[model samples]
Target: MIRIAQLSCGAEYSGIQRELERAAEIVGAKMISPEVSLEDVMDVEKRFGVSVPSGDLNLIMARATRLVENPDLADAVFVATCFRCAEGAIIRGEVRRYIHEHSRLPVLSYSFTERTTAETLLTRMEALVTTARMRGLLARERQTGLTAGIDSGSTTTKAVIMRDNQIIGRGWVPTTEVIKSAEEAFQQALQESGVKREEIQGIGVTGYGRFLVGKHFDAKLIQEEITVNSKGAVFLANAQKGPATVIDIGGMDNKAISVQDGVPGSFTMGGICAGASGRFLELTARRLGVNITDLGKLALRGSYKSVPMNSYCIVFGTQSLVNSLSKGARPEDVAMAACHSVAEQVFEQQLQEVEVKQPVIMVGGTSLIEGLPKAMEDLLGIEIIVPNHAQYIGAVGAALLVSGMLEV
Candidate 1:
């Protein structure tokens, strides 16, 4: 079992520590809290250059420093704090960064509310386990034989057929019935690739409906999108050999992942509201009387600064759009503002949790939006690469990883 060290404060008092352990147990991993001495706790303030009144917080710092000194104590690190505690939040980031920089172990950081449940942490734990146990598979540089990957996402379903490191076919469609949509996408890919179904050696499924679709298709791999999407993003961008960051702004959520050598070392996903998601942009395009595709081009023609927008809630974001148009703001400017609003929230909520490394690759359907990437570039002050077929990221990742199963 992968041993995941927990460096957290307030989880026990907040009554959510059991949820964390349950999440790790469900993913077939062990959650271990490193032993720290009273002496070690006392020296933490002097050694780490931080002072805290809370003994629990001090112990957290001591545990983090101990992990750095003894890297093999855990396969990965999970740093967390109560969402309501300001000091714990700050120290959480410091601990995460400290462990990440000092050791090669994968690190995941989260701020949990009292309501946080095992289901909420399941994906994170699964990603940690996958990162620790499947490094060789994730670091595999090439695809072999025939494989197909299907992404049953919240907004759309995508399918890809790959043969020996090259994509031969692709399919995309709006999500309706989960199994029906997945099958439709797979059939389209199968027909496009001109390959018989029986000849394909492996199949992979990912996204929100992965469990349902994976069971229906007998998928060789049923994985979460965090690891799968990062792999696909780097693969499509051809940045698998070095450090890279992937930002996927999806319909329901957003993910910011920091990767090294094609494997995800750290990642953050989800947001406070839909204001930071592609769905918000879809609403913006509807109000502007333009197709979603045209919103990007329209945004490029105007400046976001000309319009006042909210990035906190989707309802308020749409209200801002209505009020802007009422005030005679150009549809073009409104378009840019909407894109920037989503980008801004993503930058604040998700990007801040993980260290951003370059070359940054933006994937998912939202990446096709010219203004979204442009807005991210403006916020990040770096060029964002939207690779060919960026929209099929999950499907591509599924296809790529399942190819490894063919060798066995």
Candidate 2:
């Protein structure tokens, strides 16, 4: 496999790097970039006696050298530079020269400006990845078989079966006993697909109880929820033609993942509090004498825009809702407010520093709530993409991971 090391500076270049990652994926090369800190740059300048003109440039150069010199880390190097920045241009040249002299690795560079379009960046990146592939830098063995992925989420267990790169069957059931729930879901999927257990090549597991479920099923691969979700989002985006930012709101926790080039770039998760999760919404809905399924629809009928909820604690928020109802607040208005509160918690607390780009992909059980996505779109000013089987995305992603392993 070709592992390409990436070097870039500044938050301004993040979008450009994401586009580069997408391009690399199209050509089957894995990209790995190390994070660089200001202190690390200063240490490099003092230790190596290399004159770095600026802290940003110093950090880029330092990270580049470290990645290039580690044979296990990268097989080639890729650099991105700002178009009109003289300092960036100088640093890129120095970094490239140093890598070529010391490691003799192939280095490909791309320049981008503030006005650079996604198409332009992708075009250049495709060429670079293609060149690396042609030079025999990428290789992989091939395998073929059916695979199963099971996701044992906090409130639900989901299983999916895949064969020949397509989903054959899937099943979902509420989570009760971890082992029983996983087995029930997997059996349903297997029966639907008409595939015997012995025919399955491998099984992969993920989610809150992934370790337990994996052990129970004797799964060959076990992975975290974030990694599998990102992989699943990337798989979905490939069919639609763009990168995706996945927002997964489950029963207990919520996650936000940024996927570029069929891989996860960055992610953030909500705190341990259940205030921003599906369970909170269900509890609040019951207190208001409304069904959880009807909450989203009723919220859309609301005409009043109330103040943001002061507290995100589930207990406090429930009490506040009761108080609001006593003051003649409509049920619809309260429900909409709850949705807004959840969105606010995710954006303001969890994803405070993360950049959320469009076509936002909404997943998990809470994503099925109509008012929640609307509230989120209103807050972020971007359209949300809710896939057909949002709740099963993590399971599908786990299956994809097993498929890749079979090829290796």
Candidate 3:
């Protein structure tokens, strides 16, 4: 069995350990002998006395080279390390150092969605080039030709392959290095589409990493969220008129795009504090012992009484969860508070004060909340709709931006 070691700063998150376990089980792999362990990485933080907020990501990152370089550690096939930080070079340099000085295991260092999103942007851009090749071979002359698009966000990298106007394959992976992650996702989607690389016709890229991706792929690249979001919106629009407000809760930000006649016309996005966005919901869900996807469902039958959960700051909101638990609050009420909190923070009072006439499109990963739609509907006096493939919207939109290529 292939063994993998997962080490993150104690300050980073235990969730990193949990995710490593889940990935291993899916691949029929095993954990390292010690499974999960931590080497004190708090020295740097102690030196600063406040969250590094900018340098070294975390203290643990700078020391990875020393920990993984142990000579006895040759058995690992995968080494997944999560570090919170500011620069990609800082993270990648340490991983390279460990590989050269310690074990030779194939390694991947994870940048939690907060700092930088996507696994490898360059890799994914290259992979989309491959996807474009496959599109041509699979259905060169079909209007529903195979095509690929990628959306790189602050939190995740999503890719999708569509064949002749119908959905055939899709992939949603955490965004790290936008390029590499994009390549992996595009390759995976093509594999599922059963088309080899030469069959792809074209590729499109959109979002935070789009400019960087554009520098890599020979295919077309776009940076407009409006175009990209709309590309995805049309697929999920509830009617010819569609939903009134599109709520996009992204990893680092939240955007409120108003839809007029099924197209985005104007928008508002929250500031860095996350007053209105997806991260708050994700953090809240984690603390509540429920997956974000289960959050909406959990809120379905909750009592109307709420704890008033709006806060622009994610850190303050976290503290709020702790306080609520101590006060003997039900998880459901807290979940409702979370839903209401994000909605209120994400949109203007104009958004809340207005008795939501249009169906709200809760886009992005937060829509996965199983109970949020209900809680939101209850508080805002309006219904919410989470699309089946809401998570892939950005990727689909990005791929759609790929210019039609000469079938080669």
Q: Among these predicted structures, which one has the highest TM-score?
A: 1
Query: Cα lDDT of model 1 overall?
Result: 0.92
- Residues 1-408, model 1: lDDT tens digits: 899999888889889988999999999998899999889999987877997988888899999989999998999999988886889887887887788778889999999989999999988889889999898999987888899999999999999999989999888989999999999999999999999889889999999999999999999999999999999999999999979999999999989999999999888888889999999999999988999989999999989999999968999998999999999999999999999999999998888888888899999999998999999999999999999999998999999999997886
TM-score head-to-head 1 vs 2, winner: 1
Query: TM-score-based ranking, best first?
Result: 1, 2, 3
After best superposition, candidate 1 residue 68: deviation in angstroms?
Answer: 1.7
Segments in model 2 whose C-alpha atoms lie over 4 Å from true places: 1-144, 237-242
| 1 or 2, greater by lDDT | 1
Predicted candidate 2, C-alpha RMSD = 11.8
Which of candidates 2 and 3 is the stronger one according to TM-score? Answer: 2
Q: lDDT (0-100) at residue 43 of candidate 3?
A: 51
The number of the candidate with the highest lDDT is: 1
For candidate 3, the TM-score is 0.59
Model with the higher lDDT, candidate 2 or 3: 2
The reply for model 1, stretches above 4 Å from the true place, is: none
- How many clashing pairs in candidate 2? 0
